[model samples]
Target chain A: MCGALNPDELTLLSRHTRQIEHPSGEELVGESTRVEAYDNLMRGVVKLSKTLEDGRQQIVGLQFAPDLVGRLYAGESPMTAEAASDVEVCRVPRATLERLIERNPALRKRLMDQSLRELDEARDWMVTLGRKTAAEKVASLLLLIASHLDPEAAGERRIFDLPMSRLDMADYLGLTIETVSRQFSRLKKDGIITITANRHIEVLSLAKLQARCG
Target chain B: MCGALNPDELTLLSRHTRQIEHPSGEELVGESTRVEAYDNLMRGVVKLSKTLEDGRQQIVGLQFAPDLVGRLYAGESPMTAEAASDVEVCRVPRATLERLIERNPALRKRLMDQSLRELDEARDWMVTLGRKTAAEKVASLLLLIASHLDPEAAGERRIFDLPMSRLDMADYLGLTIETVSRQFSRLKKDGIITITANRHIEVLSLAKLQARCG
Candidate 1:
């Protein structure tokens, strides 16, 4: 991991950094566009997606708070990044970042660590997408969101607000909206979760949810 | 990418680095095991895979010559790294590699670049796993291998040897072996490719294969 940056390096980075906000469903970066800056998400979530020539789209990744937003060393964005919710991010121009990375070894190492972590997460998600059943995929996604929303929650029951819509959830989980909805209802009837109005979900039993994930 | 390490740093790394070989089908690193070293594949192909408790496995990524073999910062190996063909690697201890990264900025930048590249590839594969049909997936895999094996081949016909077996191809494409074989037959029947003995493949029409990938 990037160990630490000196004060001068930090000051140089801060001088080039600017904060920006986007509303829900806003496109942060369009696919194949020239990447101008790196955005570090300060709040809310973003979905990274790609679309085929025939208009089929797949949500490849979800970026949460503190996740870096752009690909480094690439001339153009490979996927479209859209704001899943109202989000705030600190943006640094790509040129400025490259300069900072050249001068600050710690920052470069940190970026490398971030990329490796993302790669690991992407590979894990491939397993879910390729091998898991629809039910298991939904359960895995819920568990992912629950843990991301509250990392310290270690109890029998937990609750979190769904950050994205059911349609987005279907895209992320590689299922149809009806299938996702049916699975949710099944989980609710099975007493594994309680879904209230406005996309609020309370996981009644972590054990049961994990069982469903299998 | 550790670009042009200083002579002293290079010597230091080389001192700790040793060439090792693994036979095809040998497991190099087991999942969840303690990672002790970093491997730089010098020859042949390797597959990084993960398996479920139910014994379902997915080949998440394929590493070819000159690709790094192990995750840097993580303690436990998240996926199993297996030799897809008889492979040789330059093995450097994790501690040594970390020290090299810390002391050599160029090496660190190179590594960071490598990680970012891998992340990009992983996201691309996620699209294939989540959205592509079985035939598309098989075509995509073929295209991937064809391009990797011979990037300079721009003609209508190209030939390359597949490093892995049908089972591995099925796992990587998220399809049954029967489906993969059937697709190959379909492609052959359609005059898209020719499958020779010893897993050799000749792509008759690259455009047709690309069309199938859609």
Candidate 2:
């Protein structure tokens, strides 16, 4: 969610934020915990997930650096949030953040714009959940990862880091780990993407990947 | 999405509202058209929907009396909003509402609460989209309609009104119209819910409906 933040607005928001860091695999917010603070990520990734009664885990949303987390002024959180990598965040107390937003019209506008964008992303995920095939889902997930790594690299052949494990990717995409692995293997077999041992992926054929995504 | 509103907040929100009547089958916002204003239903119902390139329609969400429409400050709507019945709405300019929210912290909090609730609902819908069977989908949709009709009548057996057509229900459940009809027939045949001539439904057995919903 890009914001049209002038320097003045940016400075105002920054004034209210405090820097905080968490090591990889640390729980940022636990399920049923009172959401006292909200953070805008300065660096690294987090996964927002929920577990079912049968212990099946589902990855609901992912927060990249610069994305917001820990629901602003929400009463309670239904899911758990954890840092998937070494994470740096700028945290603001719920009341302070609310006060700032209420005072600054531009900040409020930016927040509303971000909320709308998140809503659109959720709706798009609905399409994937409802109709897309496993291969298409894998392709879409890769496309998301590639764009996040470098938005300009979306149309180019470039190496990108895969932030999450195959298990996390499987949960996020509503597929089994085996299915995710199989799809990645199929992509490599078709000369669409090259995977490195260190979890780096190179897009060999962006158009072909897009075709598989549909 | 219903909320408890104090008299002052309710009056302030209702102050600039103008009620307009819309018959069934009226489109409040269409695809590709820029959304100019947000609306709140004063009476009746509205359905939010989107259509695929192949003409497959999906009802993304529904709005009841006292529910807000359009993205709060967004100028263009991603989904079409249509009158599911002879509906009445209080339309307000986006700028005015934004200003009102900026000035009133309570109002802003209420709006954020609503958005978060809607987000949670969307996530629950994701579970259905990703996992539930067609029968479960239809059952879930019917229960949602039933609850909206009367929030307090959860345990009691009761009949409720259907604001939309079979086709609309079908779209919302991501099933064929025939499939929806068949599901209703099966439910009625099995004594779970009874359907009357004007699209009215009576859940004869709540337990049976709940069982089918899973």
Candidate 3:
């Protein structure tokens, strides 16, 4: 979030872009699909996941607005990516992106910066996966969702909507759906959040959420 | 491993690098320490870890030779990096690296490619953390370490040494030390691997390991 590209940079980025949309439940990248084109998330959420032969599955990552999808220069995708919600993404062919990178030094630099930032996020998630408790996991996910929902409200304490379903949350956090529901109930009972209809969540105390995260 | 920068490209990668070596058990980037530099593992291995106030610890990652250690330009390190063994690293000052990027576009592209590769590895680890059993986790860790240890061994089945300790491996895999040890024993009993010592593990059945990974 710190090293965002300026208008000129954004214009340079737009040179390699094409738009495509995926409805909810659509697969963005399929199993055994060759990595033909990469995408930059323009709207909605996508989940990168894999399924086992026995039918168990795990959500590897959540790609949000402005997040880059697919391998930059790789020839194939190893996992499947599905639209967790309705998604609109800017598709950039690998060859075209390579040409753009080769032609524009500033564009290449910006991409380097973005890649480094994504690596930092990956390392942060490592902490989440390795150390955090189930309660902390849910808390961290909520906080993350809140921060992304409204960047303006990120610095200050404020509530935000959870865009994904409880099942999605369960898979993403490596917990059962029942555990996710129980955690939600616990949070609501503790006055950390208020749940309303249509899966709306109102964070009551960001401080309390942070405490639970720890 | 195939498309990564060559030795000559690696030489051109010099951008204000500082060489440092830490003996076993020394902490490099502890929690609360300012992450002023991005480190590349020139030799040996480092363990990235974190501990809660309650004394429970988790090992998030193991930085091996030729792996990049820190997130470039990160304002803070989310976990502590300690010497898993005696380790040698090339540390680059963040601002200096920025200046170098401004001057050299080709080098920036190379680094971006490196970061993207790391991002893929992290996502793979996310799946391991989310879905894999302890036995599968150890098996996956072995496969990863094998690839890093011997790129030439690709397309051929071979075993390799695990650089990290059982405790370190357990922490990284999000399992208790005893659990990790038990998984190793199970694998050994199943003829998946031959444990010569606590540190030396040789893969006896690569196909079995892969199947176990699934």
Q: Pick the DockQ winner.
A: 1
In angstroms, give how far residue B35 of model 3 lies from its true place.
Answer: 3.5
lDDT of 3 at A26: 95
Best by TM-score: 1
lDDT of 3 by residue, A1-214 (tens): 1125456656766776767888999988886689878777888888887667776677777777777777677777867888888999888777766766676665565667666666667667767777778899999999888878866864436666678888888777878888988999999898888988837778878888988876
Candidate 1: tens digits of C-alpha lDDT, residues A103-209: 76666666777788888999999999989999999999999999988779888788999988888888887788999999999899999999999499999999999
Q: Tell me which residue pairs clash in candidate 1.
A: B1-B110
Please provide, for model 2 over B1-214, each residue's C-alpha lDDT reduced to its tens digit, 9 standing for 90 to 100.
Answer: 1244466656776676566788888898887678777787778888887775656677777777677777776567777899988888878767767667666666676777667667777776766666566898888888887888866885748688887788887777767789888888889899888778958888888888878866
How does chain B score by TM in each prediction? 0.96, 0.89, 0.83
What digit string (tens of lDDT, one per residue) describes model 3 on residues B90-164? 887777656665666555656676677777877778778877788889888888887777667654367567777
Per-residue C-alpha lDDT of model 2 across residues A89-206, encoded as one tens digit per residue: 8887788677667666667766766666767677667666665679988999898888888787545486788999999888888778899999999999999989889388999888
> Which one is best on lDDT?
1
Candidate 3 CAPRI category:
medium
Candidate 2's docking class is acceptable
For residue A9, model 1's alpha carbon misses the true position, in angstroms, by 4.2
Position A29, candidate 2: lDDT = 90
lDDT of 1 by residue, B49-106 (tens): 9999999999988888777789889999999999999999988899988877787766
- What is the DockQ ranking, best to worst? 1, 3, 2
